[model samples]
Target: MNSLKGHPKGLYLIFATSTAERFSYYGMRAIFILFLTQALLFDKELATSIYGSYTGLVYLTPLIGGYIADKYWGIRRSIRWGAVMMGLGQFLLFLSASMLHTPGWAHGLMYGGLTLLILGNGCFKPTVSSLVGQLYTPGDKRIDSAYTIFYMGVNVGAFIAPLACGYFGETGNPDDFKWGFLLAAVVILLTIVIFETQKSKYLLSPDGKQLGVLPDARQQALSAEQAKSASAGEQSSRKWRNLGILAALALVFGTLFYLWLGNDWVSVGIFTACLVFPISILLDSSLTKIERERIFVIYIIAFFVIFFWAAYEQAGASLTLFAAEQTDRVIWGWEMPASWIQSFNPLFVVLLAYIMPAFWAFLNKRNREPSSPAKQAIGLLLLSLGYLFICFGVKDVQAGTKVNLMWLTGLYFIHTMGEIALSPIGLSMVNKLTPLRFASLMMGLWYLSMATANKFAGMLGGLYPEAGKEKILLGFRIETMYDFFMIFVIMSGIAALILFLLSKKLRQMMHGVE
Candidate 1:
């Protein structure tokens, strides 16, 4: 049952599921900060911080979700549960918006909704991504191209989300935001219905085995025993060592949370477990030398990913603010919604996704393709260029004067190109390089990088110049928007240069995987 140009039937199913899920997520995100500021009356700093914390936790929880899928729940069950949770979350947000006049209740409902969304995203994001990897066999050349197509599905949802959600949410009185959240819930329910109906027919491996089915308890125990024997020839001792590590990590995190975050035990516990689980895996005694090298490459790339995402994810926070406050968004005598700018990246993605795989295929045929690391380096360079374009375009603009919309649109185009070069490629890289036994867990670790980046993005967004407010960040006085934009230009440019310089060494560490 080949569909989508000879890809497996399951590929399209995953694509649909991913697309709908992204629609739900990006739709809410498109108006989240604006809703906070305009409807809830939160300041920019507070809204950005909440945005950062919400997104950060959304990525962070995937570590636990992925581990559960790997060990017990399996991908299918995890995804279903995640969809339900996210639907509930969206509904809560809808209720929150409905109660906009009731500040206390609305605030509580909003936080509760955010928490559920974070948890649901953890379960949904990594498992679905791992399943996509499962659709192809090891060493399949088509995997990269398949991820590219899947990523295009992601952008399809992202592109439509703001246009649909933003229109209803932003066009009317501020109180109308509930309709958008309600729409997101409806779309997510539709996604669940589609997947539940079609999965039995289409979601299968190449060998015709059902994908994402959990093993029986007996089989799971056997596999656990095998892993223990492989690790140190002593199951009990290894279990104790792992438990000790977890306990120690919990204690450390608990202390930190008490001291720094006003005793936020939930955050402490979740982050502690996220950090500890990966360390335990990396310390496993059974890894082959080649496996260790490949894993090390993943870690190195994950480090660089933090920088990449820190800048790229500004689209949701700082860039959104810029669109609302600085960019001239009038089109044909009507002022466009600020969230409409959120659509530009995905629009460029839809355009470029078609061109990129063919470009890479051409390079491959001629034996001239750049290594994945090199492509990622180029992506960072492009990201820097995007920010530099904004910096230069806004250099002379005054605080009250709106810059041309082209500046923001052009920046999104360049950033979209950068994203195409890096984001899907990074997903493919993790799937390709991960040991099969740790597939979901490793994917979770990959998202952990995003977790860190998102938190940093929030911090950066907080630095965005408020009207008539000047502040010093990293010793630079950000009196104008240009100064704020230049920080990203400098940061991403240096990161790109460093990555380009180190690409050769990183490629060597891949042990010929690419």
Candidate 2:
């Protein structure tokens, strides 16, 4: 029995808690915009802005969450509090969702609900991600594989949430929408209960037993290694005192620079990160040559990943709306829900994530496995092609009319193909490149790029002019939406080419670290 127990009980606890929370989050998020527009009668632009801001804030807060977890409350207690906040948030969301069409009260409830959710997710996201890191031993090979498995859990929850909950969210029956919100609340409550029940078995001590000391076997060994390295002329640990001031400086610098851009503080801060952190790393001489080179390659990979997400994120912002108000969902006299279209990316990730590793293994054996950068470049190209299909397909439909759901479906397939090539691999790359000391921080930085990309996607999505006459190609007139897709395709194609040119040099920089 002991031999079978290789992984920590804490890891399973994290998974269970995360799955329930993701279910609740995605369940609501998948349909949130449509709920705002259709149910609350907000203007399209206002609703889009609201949704964009909500999601952008969701990604942005993990910086604070990670900090608090590392310094004070720690993952287990933080997650416990997070689960409560989330449950409350879901109930508030239900209140809003149920009363959405009920005039002035609805708007107040909506704002309150959004606030609770934003705060709850802030606490939840970073603690969970860090806890996953805590579960493995130092230099454990299973660690990376473990996260990949956990990543799959996230997508699995994401995949199922929309389809099952989306049906209720947008059902023709009014009761179903209310029921959906209520069900979301229930899911969050259950998550809280489950975690509480298991906490003693897993995380009786949320913080380490010793103040300012490491907790697990992994951290114990890590401290020993650090001692040896320091004896061998490495400098003493960068004390906690310096990190806060540095991070504060970065935050302040980022804030001042981006506040002028828009009201979107998150959008500005993270783009500034994509600029600032890598530069700061370069200027630091304390870093090992290996660390500097590895981080440099990581930055280039992050850049390409940014391009990939800018296109993929369209599934929620522009693409979902297009499906709802525009796409001809009446196929065989059945009206498919627009939010359901959002489900495909997660669905594909769940089914195909495992398969791709095997495919890579086969390709590696044949000496045909493309490098990570090459795979990501290919992902960008495929995403570009997906946008091309959408650009053309939108044109093939009647003006001011809904297009076929099949077009969206086809586009998702292409997006998924691209995702398989790059998405999981990107996580693996980040984990590989990041030094253990800065592991959590680097992961936070990678997500910082995602946060920015998401915001940028929305900002650019808002750029599709409502009344522009667009160009035609292949006997189809490209509307504003199509033109947008074309722009993305061209943008990514150029990026992919540039990255491919630098691919060899960047690979050399990695020095086989990955």
Clashes of 1: 0
**What TM value does model 2 have?**
0.82
lDDT tens digits by residue: candidate 1, 1-514? 5556768879889999999999999999999998999999998888888888888888888988988888889888889999999999999999999999899999999999999999899999999998887888789888998899899999999999999999989875889999999999999998899889998888887888888887222123334544656445476687788889777886886777668656544445444554566677777666678888888888777778778888998998889989998888989999999998999999899999979878888999999988998888889999999999988789988778999999999999999999999999999999998887788888999998888788778878888888666668868787788988888888888988988898899899899899
- Residue-level lDDT of model 2, residues 137-181, one tens digit each, is 445656645665677777777887888778877875543565666
TM-score of each: 0.94, 0.82
Best by TM-score: 1
- Residue 264, candidate 2: how far off, in angstroms? 4.2
Candidate 1 off by > 4 Å: 1-4, 215-233, 246-277, 468-470
Among the numbered candidates, top lDDT falls to 1
Shift in Å, residue 481, candidate 2: 2.5
Question: Pairing residues by index, what is the TM-score of model 1?
Answer: 0.94
